[model samples]
Target chain A: MKTARRNKLKMNAFAWMLLFPSLIFLILFTFYPVAGALKTSFYMADLSTPQPIYIGLDNYKGMMEDDVFWKVFTNNIWFAVGTVPTSILLALLMAVFANKIVRAKGLVRTAFFYPTLIPMIAIGNIWLFIYTPGYGMLSRFLANFGVGDINWLGTQSLVMIAMIIMVVWKEAGYFMLFYLAGLQNISQEMYESAEVDGVPKWKVFWRITFPLLMPTTLFVSIIALTNSFKLVDHLWIMTKGGPDNASNLLLYYVYEMAFKFWDQGMASALTTVMIALLLLIAAIQFFGLDRKIHYR
Target chain B: MTKKISYTLMYAMAIIWLIPLVWTFWTAFRPKKLALSPSITFDFTLANFSHVWQGAPFSTYYLNTLLVVVGIFTVQFLTATMAAFAFARIDFWGKQLVFVLFLAQIMIPADILIFPNYTTLRDLSLLDTKLGIMMPYLASAFGVFLLRQMFKTLPYELDEAARMEGCSLWQILWKIYVPLSRPAYISFGVVSVSYHWNNFLWPLIVTNSVENRLLTVGLAIFAQSFETGAQWSEVTAATIIVIIPLIIAYMLFQRQFMNSFIHSGIK
Candidate 1:
């Protein structure tokens, strides 16, 4: 009995030994910082001062009263609303078209998927040229249609639209790959039967194809939703969340507060909200959406 | 007729979609004066490339990015392998709880931890270093989970056979398990490389100086120079410098890359 107990203890030690390095990192970077962020949110840590004054709930209250905070928050929701559906719809269309083509399918797939492979920063930089005021690619293209020069990224009304268009273009190709995989998994027999019934192509897509792609849509929606919050790399390159914070996102605003403004307290509070939002997403995915995603 | 229409539409969309990339190459090869002109002629020159090369220390940026990506991947590979082995093969107390904690970490986006992580780096005196940029990413929950899933799919008989051959636990892991999971490793490696290579926000916040800047940040600094906004050729050339390696690698291993993405997504 003692021998077996000692052997079990030895195995436990060995397992933990292997996990030591990774556990240290997970604790230090993720868990420790999360706790620290939560703690700091309650204390006003003026970096210039030696001691931080404990200011409980003030940071949260400040956010409640801040117009910019509300704007930034709403802008993020709008951004998600703008990018998520459009990208998914475009991806579904792209996948359907790519799936239909019998010739040069590889070439067509490449054209659609290439953007997803490149970095968002590169895409942002490229589109910065395209959105440049005069003599820009976008301007030149519009000018050919006798349209006047419209500052794409400069005007507040059009800035989010510009950001949305660029993001949709970047993300649709990636989401298309998921749809393509889902489309391929769909049984050919079902399509054959539907065709034998002489169903219209749109009805076939709506009734059979669309319903079958529900799991892919759910998966892609979660990804796209996460990305809408996470992807502020483009803002850094293109607008720097400028034109009166018109293009600012929740995470971007957190960054500006933490790094640029150096307000660690408010930043932590903002981060807490971001975490809350992420938790909401997790809840929606696991509880609300996962049941609907069939596992066949 | 429908087939013909689909072909034409697909081809047109494909061409339209690729125009930005094509436009990038076109503008990169053109001279500064003719880059924005409404002409279809290919007045190509390598002058923009030469100018952009000397304009910034791009070579250093490339080296820094290469080192950061490789460094993060190397550390991640080692840590993930060991942790995954324990989780997959070793039965230990609290293993399920520990694994759940790891999954929870995956849900917490790294961006949200920027402040506290920055403070941690500052406290450690590792600020403005490439290690700072690579540190938070070293313990990737995704990597550990990926490797654990991969390891679990293998039969225990392989480990048993290796043990009978007098192989140690470490040897069985590296020799038996690692060799059989090449596809998983390759897929993970490709995903990790692309992720860290193009990673901007974390690296942007961590590194401040030109010496430690990655290619994305370096390109950002170059493009942010408002005076050079009209210097379309040079900006595009700089952009090309940052993205060309990834584009070439993607083109070469297009199948593997796409398959890896597909696999990761479905998983």
Candidate 2:
């Protein structure tokens, strides 16, 4: 019996040994950097100057007062507001259509999903050409209807709209995959029973399919919200948060502060804020919204 | 009538989703002069394809991308498998807290870590190295969580049977668990490979020279020449070159790719 207990302890030790490398990586790369960023946010670093000055909450105070920061913050909120609901709804619609449709289902699914496979940078580059003036595809296509050329990216009001269009196009298909899975998990018996009860298809969807898909919807929403913030990769390549910072989301603003301006301290503070926001969103989703997801 | 309207709407939406892709393919093959002309009357040709092939070091970028992707995957598979086994099978102190901490890592957008990661790379003297770009991604929290979930669903009898046959833990993992979990591995592998292959921002920041640049970053540089106006044909040609392999892979394994996305979501 003692030997068996010894063997179990040995096995547990070996398991921890197996886990060590990944733990080291997580500590050094993820946790350490996060801690470092938190520390850095309290100091003011100037590249020209030799040392970083310890300024407690000054950066945060400065950010609160900064007009550009407020603009970018509001822009990110608007971006989330614009993107999350639209993309989720579109994804559900597409998934329902794909699920119900019997003909050429694979081909239709592939076509819808193809955009998600394209790299964001490539998408940005393609859309750059599409959004270009007279010589662009959109412009020429519009010309066929005598709408004339409009600079989609150049106008401040339209820049975010253009971004939303690109984002929705890229995201809807990806989210549809989740909804498709949710749809599959809902047994056909439920729908058949509903039909036998003389329930309308729409009502069946509302009462059954929609509730069943609530978990998937919540999961997709969290992912989409995070992605909306994280997807400033395109902004880096295309707009650089321009047309007067109208297209700058939080991540792009952080990128600008860190790399473009070399304000590491301010950048760290911005990153901290972004991280805090993400954590809050994640907490709410997991604790608040996820409880509503019906589990069979 | 309502069904007809909904079907028509679906078709219209699908068509709208497809237009940019169709336009991209058209521009990729269209001759240079015609490709950029912005007129619909232009004739298609293979000139842009040929030009793109001859004008750039696309082969190197492809090789670099493949190397980085395979390298990241190879490391991730091993690390995730081992870590997941520990989390799923082993009883240890602090297991719950450790798992929660690992899950929390998934929420922190990796972009936030770039500055410190850049500094870390600089300290390691690994700047401009493909290995450097792959380093941080080698052990993903997402992978660990995914594989752990998959491992839990596997029957305990398999492990017990292997142990009864005098198999060590590693041997059991190799002979039983790994083989049984092939679907999860494939799904994780597909997602991981595609992500690393299409990764741009980290690769862009780390790789300074042409030697190490992945296809995405290489295409970015090739497409963005600020001195001159954008060249739609050349850019489309480059995008085609970058996307074709993955597109082909997707077509061949369309079902698997869709399954991976589904599994990733539900997990």
Candidate 3:
């Protein structure tokens, strides 16, 4: 009995010893910072000042009242709404067709997925050239249709659309792989049966394939949603969230508030809200979809 | 007939999707005088590459990016392996709670935590260092979770058999656990390396100097130097230089890269 207790104690010690390295880092970078950010969100922190003035909900109030924050928040939602569905649909289309193609499959798949592997900054730069007026590839292409040169990135009305198009192009191939995996996992027997019943291809897809790919869709949606919030890297290169903040996104706005504007309190407040949204979606992804995924 | 149509459509879409990249390559090689021409210029020149090289210290940016990504991956591998072993093999008090908390970290985007992390780094006097850029990512919940899942699938008998020979817990992990989980390590390593290589925003925030800038941040800044209204060829060349290594690596390890991404999704 004593040996059992001692053995348990020893095991516990070993567990802790192994856990310490990761735990220390998690605490330093994640848990501690999150807690600190939460705390700072309630206070007015001036970098020049030695002490932070505790403002108690003022930052939250400021965020609610700030029109730019609302604009950025709504712009992020629009970006997500604009990008996620189209990208997923394009991915599914690619995956379905690519799955059917036997010859040159590797070449086709590589062409689809290659953009995902490149750095977004590089892609953004490439797109910046595409959007450049009066000789840009996109402008020249449009000119061939007798359309006048369109200021793709510079115009307030079109910046977000331009950004969305670039993101969708960059992202669709990535999500296609997930759809491809999900498609491959689906039993061929189901498709065979659907065909035997004289079902049309669209019906086979809509009834059999789409329903089966639900989990992948959910997972990809969660990822794409979070990515919409997290992926402001392109904005730094392309628009700087501008033509009057039309392309401003939540994460970039938080960045602008903190680093560019030097408003840590506001940034923390914004971050707190962003974290809540991410956590909400993550919860939905993990817990909401965990039981529903058909692993076969 | 339907299959033929589908194939034709897929190929057309693929080419269309590839146009930006193809155009980047096209623009990068075009003679400076024909950089903006609608038609492809057959007058390919290395001048754009030379101009790009002269325009920025891209070599330094490459080195800095390599250091930061390697630093993050090395520490992440060690920490994740250790933590994953603990979770997989050891049953102790609060293990579940600790793991849940750790997993919760995965949900909080690192960018959202930037301000506080920046403050923490500043207080530690680690700001402006490559280590600072690497610090927040050193402990990856996804890596820990992935390794733990892989470790759990290994037979307990292997560990017990090693233990019977008087092998310590550490030795058992190093010998049996680590060796068996090579596929997991590779997949995780690919994901981590690609992610850190392409990561821009955090590195942009953390590193202030030209010397400390990673390739992504450097490319952004370089592209923004709008001295010439249409230095498209030079800008594309710089962009290509930043991305070409990854492109080459992906081409070499095409199957492995795709497999890693697919396997990462399985988690």
- Which structure among the candidates has the greatest DockQ? 3
Candidate 2 segments whose C-alpha is farther than 4 A from its true place = A292-296, B36-44, B226-230
Better of 1 and 2 by lDDT: 1
Clash count, one per candidate: 0, 0, 0
Model 3 residue B129 CA deviation in Å: 0.4
Question: Can you write out model 1's per-residue Cα lDDT over B123-189, one digit (the tens) per residue?
Answer: 9999999999988988877878788888999998888888899998888888888888888888889
TM-scores for all candidates? Answer: 0.96, 0.96, 0.96
Task: Please give, as one word, the docking class of candidate 3.
Answer: medium
Reference-based lDDT, each prediction: 0.88, 0.85, 0.87
Candidate 2: fraction of native contacts reproduced = 0.59
| Weakest lDDT window of 10 consecutive positions for candidate 2 chain A | A287-296
- Candidate 1 lDDT, tens digit per residue, A90-204? 8998999988877788888888888876778889889988898887888878998999999988999899999999899889999998998899899999999999999988899
- What does DockQ come to for candidate 3? 0.68
> Residue B176, candidate 3: how far off, in angstroms?
1.1
Clashing residue pairs, backbone N/CA/C < 3 A, model 3: none
Runs in model 3 lying further than 4 Å from the true structure: A47-50, A293-296, B1-3
- Candidate 3 clashes: the total is 0
Query: Could you give candidate 3's per-residue lDDT for residues B1-267 as a string of tens digits?
Result: 987887898899888887888888888888888877666448879999998898899889999999988899999999999999998998999997898878778788576788889999999999889988988888888998889889989998998899899999999999889999998999999999989999888888888899899998988888888763567888888988988888999999988888888877777
Indicate the docking level reached by candidate 2: medium
Using lDDT as the measure, which candidate wins? Answer: 1
